[model samples]
Target: MKYQFDKDFLWGVATASYQIEGAYDQDGRIPSIWDTFSKTPGNTYMGHNGDEACDHYNKFKEDIALLKKLGIKAYRFSISWPRIFKDGKYKLNEKGLKFYKDLVEELKKNDIKPIATLYHWDLPQILQDEGGWSNPEIIKYFVHYASVMFNALGDDVEQWITFNETSVFLYLGYLYGIHAPGIKNLDLTLKAIHNVHLAHGETVKLFKNSNYKNQIGITLNLSPNYPYSVEEKDIIAAKTNDAFWNRMFLDPILKGSYPEEILNNPFGNTLKEIIKDDDMEIISHPIDFLGINYYSRSVIKHDENETFKYKSIPQDGEKTSMGWEVYPDGLRVLLNYIKENYGNIPLYITENGAAYEDKLENGKIHDIDRINYLKRHFISAKKAIDEGVNLKGYYVWSFMDNYEWAEGYVKRFGLTYIDYETKQRILKDSAKWYSQVIKNNFIEE
Candidate 1:
């Protein structure tokens, strides 16, 4: 079977600044939260840091050349906030701006569209010291920084993502203390949640009010929650999980209100204390599209002892290197759910790919597991499109293997394999297969 995508359907790859761009301190780039957290003892795998990650800051031209070779129609990459703001202050960094400008120019030279993500979990450390996302003052700082990018890049970059994976960054950073600026406080997490949404709303307002003609939106790591069984308790537990996991973020931006279930009891009381007048209006401002980073689904079972009265039940299936189960049909179900619940707004699969145990043999990588993962997901996306969902584009999670946050370089999620020691990039079998898919704008199984 061969599934074909429209010519206008963007086929691209996604990457983040901190994950790929090494030169952490070069060219007036200040330290971000990741830098501080990764440097602290017992924070990351082997205490690994991204100080020399792929050296992309020094070899962007080479990387852009690689993108051109892959026949990608678009490239989604992030801009480092610390790189643009000196000492995490309101000062401009021309060198930092120039690097991205050069990168955009190179992508245009290769006829590839540029999609920029404003934030990808690399908050400036100075801001963290001042309470980070938990501080309302950070909203103005974020808007100012975004305004600078709007004035600098403008229409040269068409699609702009206000933030990437807010749930992962906020929950992991504040609630779980696993990612960066490691802090485990539910109070701080609740504050950070409201403030982050306010920040996103303000940025969208600024973009829409600008003279530039372009698109702006947010990317969320959404996992569709399914009940473990048909039991009424399990069903209610799944609904509760949906309220916090999906609706808490989606409702503010798409529906202009928080879930009533969440606002009723337990965590709702804390969230209510921080929300102010017109905050939801700002957070729910209209935008062009929604970017979804779908990886897996959750099976919620009733748990009287667990917080939220629910716990995830592990499903029996093939798992990725990240220990996430491979459930491709979840993508189709998620897309349909978004369309039915949030209105059929334009959508993009901003990040979808799996991490696997990639082995290099004879100067080539035969990552068949990763390839099958992508193929199944792609078909699922096509199914959604056929079912009248407004799915427009698909950007694979990564362009190359780089620093994978707390997991460090152990989990490989890229089509291109990067040699950490030599900084050499080798095209894996999946990359070759993806290149053909991009060229043909279709996939065959």
Candidate 2:
């Protein structure tokens, strides 16, 4: 077996508040968009709501114990906006603040570095009602909330991610109506998208001025666009899609401007009008690092009549339980692509894991498929590192199975399988395998 990766390479697991922290109405917490969306009939799978997902809010100590056992170096989790800002009001909830204050202490006691995400799709319902990410004023609310967290937990948490998967949440929530605060309107979605980046800029500025010696960055779920064929039409489609999805978010932060190709489009032009003076300058503020969540590549073909002027061609290969193609080499390609295009900066595989129909037999989950998925991705990451990609760390998508958004609890994407009935976490086979990878500081291949 060959080994790769620097000795200090980070190994960790990530979880979001809405997905794992059930206790929807406990201890001064208010409802988030997720709570409202999941509870509404026909919004989620089997009417599944995250009312009692993993109960991590009440079981933080036990969860930290699991991280210590796994030998993980870091733990990436999000701060629930609603938890701190009940009903999206300006007032901060002391109990909500206490919960995270205690969680940070527990993580530090276990010698685990904490990566805190300010927003992870759990928007305060009050904010959503007032146009949420769509409203430019929402920046003020986000900045205020971020400031509170920075002052409260900044000393303990050195790494902070402003937003998680900006495109996914906005597209799903505003355009597709599949996620929280569901609303289907392409025009509104476009405005919301641009403003989301603005919010990111505001948060970045807030973190930098906090006077805490900390590293701040934003996490974008980047999808590499590949042409479906050698035809000129396909090639053009791929480029345009790349600008639409990848560049729209990346270019703004790194380059401080939107791609001309994206801004010139009829829809993209609409996004242009929303860009106010000094907005790009604010968004372009230099940050400490960039976290990318890569799942798979998109193979696109030109479509004159279709929205976004491109259509996805079905990928042919082994697919995950989420129907994402199992393409480990794509991870290496994407990592190199980011380094080549975005310049060498510290980058972390903030979220990477696949959903699978896992089963528990004899008090264990024999998820060999998941183990293979992670092993291949790990090797792919190492290949990029060997080629001079400044890849710092990789955090598996989830620590345990919990509410999986629209799919509810059906899709299991965790190394540790959670028995929903008893809230008992059974470490899957992948977890055991990952423990060794962490201990070795490299993937054995």
| Per-residue C-alpha lDDT of model 2 across residues 299-417, encoded as one tens digit per residue | 99999898777898878779988999988888899999999998999999999999998988999999999899999999999999889999999999989897999999999999888
Model 1 pairs in collision: none
What's the true lDDT of residue 18 in model 2?
A: 91
Where is the poorest 10-residue window by lDDT in model 2? 83-92
For candidate 2, give the lDDT.
0.88
Q: How many residue pairs clash in model 1?
A: 0
**Candidate 1 off by > 4 Å:** none
lDDT of 2 at 295: 83
Question: Which candidate leads in TM-score?
Answer: 1
Structural similarity to truth (TM-score) of each candidate: 0.99, 0.98
Model 2 spans > 4 angstroms off? none
User: 317-402 in candidate 1: lDDT tens per residue?
Assistant: 79998999999999999999999999999999999999999989999999989889999999999999999999999999899998
Query: What CA RMSD would candidate 1 show?
Result: 0.9
